[model samples]
Target: MPISNSSFAFLIISAFLFLSVFQTHGKVIINTNGIGQHSFADMKIDCGKECTRRCQLSSRQNLCRRACGTCCARCNCVPPGTSGNADVCPCYANMTTHGGRKKCP
Candidate 1:
């Protein structure tokens, strides 16, 4: 028995379609509960919500990190020891102060 040309073409087409579908679908495995038992196609969708919540909590005015003394000197925010006077805080290192503008120490 000899394979027909149409049958051969059909077989090739079927194989190509099968391969294209298989290659397009991908799986991502996520380990949850510290036991490696979770599988997810999109972990970021879940993790991102949690991350946003945590960031919001941390960015609260009272919860924000407060640096003072020399540490404040390096910060871009209000410089150290000048918390009472924003006018005296340094803007950037090597920058000059003019007309009450702050200069980096």
Candidate 2:
């Protein structure tokens, strides 16, 4: 069967509306400072609060917050919970310190 141009156009518009509503589709967005921008186009995550939660139980809270915040800003993800489970965010997991230690808590 042959489809009309109007039908195709309607389908495209419908798909666009669906995506805009659900935000299943995203666009590249360069940030203000242009550093620590997320690769994904979704709204920015709260790295400060996330780092605070992640570093709450740390012996060195300041150090943990700094590192976790850096990783969260760059990777746009911090592993859930205060300790362990680094596997969830690969970029957060693979980051290393100058001393060859794990960077993110």
Clashes of each: 0, 0
Residue pairs that clash (backbone atoms under 3 angstroms), model 2: none
> Model 2 Cα displacement at 44 (Å)?
1.1
Model 1 Cα displacement at 38 (Å)?
14
Decoy 2 TM-score against native: 0.64
Q: For candidate 1, write residues 10-47 as lDDT tens digits.
A: 99999999888656654544333343333334222232
Model 1 — which ten-residue stretch has the worst lDDT?
A: 62-71
Q: Tell me the deviation in Å of residue 50 in model 2.
A: 0.3
Query: What is candidate 2's CA lDDT for residue 44?
Result: 76
lDDT of 2 by residue, 1-32 (tens): 99899999999999989888766647655445
TM-score per candidate: 0.27, 0.64
Give the poorly placed runs of model 2, Cα more than 4 Å off. 1-39
Alpha-carbon lDDT, every model: 0.39, 0.81
